[model samples]
Target: MALYKTIGAFLLFLGTVSGYANPGACSGTCVNTHDPSIIRRSDGTYFRFSTGGKIAVHTAPDITGPWTYKGAALPAGSSIDLGGNQDLWAPEVALVGNTYYLYYSVSKFGVQDSAIGVATSSSLDVGTWKDLGSTGIRSSSGKPYNAIDPNLINADGTYYITFGSFWKDIHQVAMKNPPKAVASGSSAVQVAFDPVKTDEEGAFVFKHGSYYYLFFSKGKCCGYDTSRPAAGEEYKILVCRSTSATGGYKDKSGKACTNGGGTVVLESHGNVYGPGGQGVYDDPVHGPVSIRSRKTIWLIMLIIFALQILYYHYVNTKIGFADGQKQFGWNTINFSSGWPVV
Candidate 1:
């Protein structure tokens, strides 16, 4: 009877093994890329953007693609140089009506002197981009504030820009038209999560199921030895939701985001430091989804294996080995030594 029971368990294990495949396949780590932005066209093509003030086009029939890069959307000489500009970073792309707008920032890392600018393109295919110039948003010294990363979202026929970094606070500016300048007297307001000292950038806001979701990345970004690899140094993507676009956003634990409460939507799986610059797009195959580069899924799988091993030892010690042998649990394995494990 015991042998029969063991055979049955073995059969079940085989069935599970046959049904379960690897977690997912992702190329090892696409290096030299950070602050990724994605846009899906009506024709089922995807265009992605990064910090260098350039946009790259990738086409795929599905969202999870063998995404092939066509070319850069912004031309070589299209970069902007604001007062004492350093480098262009953190590009956010939005589509409204028939036009596509690319919002980007110019700043030195760790400096509040940053400026955000816009560029418009009627067709995202190849040529057709026109730089709409800067919005005159700057810091007190006539220099740019880190608070200038622009994230555009339209609500109720009116467009709103959520722009800010860690220096001051995240602010919202309303626009009468989509992808245009803010309305007169539309001063910025402190909204969503605020970081006391850490730099909070890449603020992306969207509406889902009557709830306005605020997604932001906080912590250090874009430096090799810049404390990102250490614990708490890792950048994480956090999320909060509210009924209104401006206030009452709360985490899953029901803590208000205004009080610095946030639920982590995504985090670095492994060597994927600062996997924060995110964008959402509508795919013909997967409906609405987000695309951002990170460490490959293989790293996540290794962590899962390590956790399973630790759990197996913990279960064997807590519960008697013989009793554990008969217990049904996830991914259980029975060894010849009468030890049952996961």
Candidate 2:
């Protein structure tokens, strides 16, 4: 109980540091989530789609959510004829027209025979999801990229799905309309790569101003329990930007992202370790207000919850994800110096 309280206090401190207009913070009992993607409905309801429990669907009245699990989007698992369809991973949601499409990953750990699946919903409620099978994105042992961590981004007017894993880091491909699958005759383009075994993955592209910010997770991700991955080798969030969403992204040092260059957006700090599995969203009342689509006002709020498991600060020190299994966290993101500081 004391550990939980300490976690709460850190969350509050994070919000205070971010400098929100209201300085609202969140910290409570949170279930674990992997590769989470959150989006707000027209009614201001927030839906969080994540891995496990057949793409777990949790809804909340607010961003600092007392989130309530509604039901699995694919209760019986994906309709795709993949071997690990039952154990789907990396769910990314996109609202295209009146339909909400939820893209998921189908694979096991360390296996290259993987595919990205999709399902559609009109209301994002139980019994509303219709499986759409594969998005024609898959990877094999000989492939350079893995087909997990499906992140859909609407770059300018074109749609693209950026995904990959440890195999070759992150890759992007042009996506056609409706976003049920990749664009015809489109080939996967390498966007970001690390020469050192390429431990980066979980890529999310957010369009802020004239630049499209690409956020991704780097270093070892799972199976944490002391003396693992060293200290700096643990998972952390990194970012790069490109004028064109397809390629040519660079870090703050102006280093090309494809050549193992990335700027650290979020990393181990105090009690939060391996802080990754990130996505940026616009909240109507949190960070920076902007106009998205209609006349609705929105702010920037990022979801960076993928740590193995972190507890409270003990004796002025907090442990890393090597302590426990896994859990989740979210915080408001404020911009500074033309960078969306996560």
Candidate 3:
């Protein structure tokens, strides 16, 4: 009982420092998402698509989910010729007209040999997809910009996509009507680049009131097993905003996003590590929602719970331990400051 009290106190301290008790979003199977892009059905069900195994799909009845794995959005892999890995990375889902378009990335680890492909589905279910082929976007050996992590946006009906990494960070291109393809002869523009860190990608844009917010991830991701990661290497979510969707994004400190300016939205805290690869969805109930991936604290709790079970059985045990009750609750984080409290 004393050990449990200490653990609870430590968690409370961490939450006080981080300005959040727990993320008010969904958990359980709903929490295991990476580069997540979420969309809502007509029946109020939320479908979440993410990076992995040809684009994994999860669905839930509410935004706060008891998410269940459905299947891959793209089962056969990408039609793009530059593929070295069939496992898609960073899926962005958008509803255009009556159809849903899924944009995914194909790359060879850290190399610039990458392409963004699209697949269309009339319904968000398994085996209902048709690959729309590549968006004619690619990053070659000598190109300054990467052509992965595609995010489609509509600026007053004109479609555009923002994508890139490493070499020149984030770039935007004018997209054609259906948005599965780039506009003919439309030049890609350099939007957001980090001159200092040079480690920005997973760009997602959301328009709220008077500004278009550009959210990107910086530093290394997917290195969870490392003994102790450095501050700069751990994945964290950052944001900048622009009046126009095209350019001139700045952080809260009035620094240019091109010159390595970004305000941290979410970062590693306690057992929740490497939070990045985010997407924004406008919820009918919760208003605006941000989704991402992080190794959560509950895994650590489970391990501790198992150890407690062993301690109670074989070691010094608590009296009437079986009579102890556990309760779980939720507390929503306020995002009026343009970021989740953390």
Candidate 4:
């Protein structure tokens, strides 16, 4: 049974990502964001948060939106001594157990000194957030990993955070509920590393079917000055999956993610350059949506709606319901062979 399930999952993964087009990109109000993260509210408002002063906020009624700047998640900056610039980066938001957890990075540029902090809000609105201080995850000189670019995921029954950039690439640690702190005595584990062993960040993980997929960006992430980027330095997204959420992730070619293996999910295409710093939201209307920020923010909304419909059609037809009617029921009336049943 397990083997059959695994085979089914592999087939689904292959079929879904095959010839995938670039997710629809949106500009105007959604552009120019640094490390943007998006989440849909209960009321259907799509809120986007990004790296900037007080963690900038934007909102729109739909996914492809004329995103209007609403406010900042943390207006006063972090309580920690973040090396004086008082700016935040990589805002990752998730609603877990009746509270909205907004995690942001507080650090000085190009330095190993950094901390991933958390803010709590019952209502995901600006100024309603109360600082919960740091998550006790930090990095400094001589450490293998730099603690930045935090992404929170609630997998199975446990909450885990995947973070870090450059250096040793991305790492993950278990979190306690309310998501304010790492669980006591839980050692951080390195999950995904860049093949060149540099510049991997914005790691997000989610489970689909029987596998847990890890998505991360690699290459030169912030070089907006296109005139001077090194060869293969353009940031791109890649993914790998494992049955367990903790580790042992592998790409489509069956290479382990720990060995710097990943299937390229998205990269530079058209006007979208250096697309990275992504987060995924399971929208009620569209299922699971993967959101990433680039030279422009690509929302990738509603496209999954069509996929969902097609998946239903695929499953239904696979079970011999090709005509949208089961073979066992009276509704399976033959119309082509004779008169339709009343």
Every candidate's lDDT: 0.54, 0.74, 0.70, 0.66
Error in Å for residue 78 of model 2: 1.1
Q: Give each model a TM-score.
A: 0.69, 0.83, 0.79, 0.77
Q: TM-score order of candidates, best first?
A: 2, 3, 4, 1
lDDT tens per residue, model 4, 247-317: 99888888888887987765554433455566554544444344432132222322222122000001012
Clashes of each: 1, 2, 0, 0
lDDT winner, 1 or 4: 4
Question: What lDDT score is found at residue 323 in candidate 3?
Answer: 11
Displacement of the residue 221 alpha carbon in candidate 3, Å: 0.7
Candidate 4: residue 291 lDDT (0-100): 44
Of the candidates shown, which would achieve the greatest lDDT relative to the real structure? 2
Q: Which residue pairs collide in model 1, if any?
A: 114-144
* Winner on lDDT (2 vs 4): 2
Model 4 misses residue 160 by how many Å?
A: 0.8
Model 1: ten consecutive residues of lowest lDDT = 307-316
Top candidate on TM-score is 2
Using TM-score as the yardstick, the better of models 3 and 4 is 3
lDDT of 1 at 57: 46
lDDT of 2 by residue, 110-228 (tens): 99899999899999887799998999999998999999998998876789999999888899988888788889999999999999668989898887668888888898777665446
**True-structure lDDT of candidate 4:** 0.66
Residue range 1-342, candidate 3, lDDT tens digits: 687556645544554576534345554464335677778899898787876768888888875677788888888888777665477888888889999888888997788988888988898787998988789888898988888889998999999999998898999999889887889999889888877778898898877667898888888765344343576576677889989999999999999998889987666544445556776655544542222322466434323322110000000012111111100112333333444333
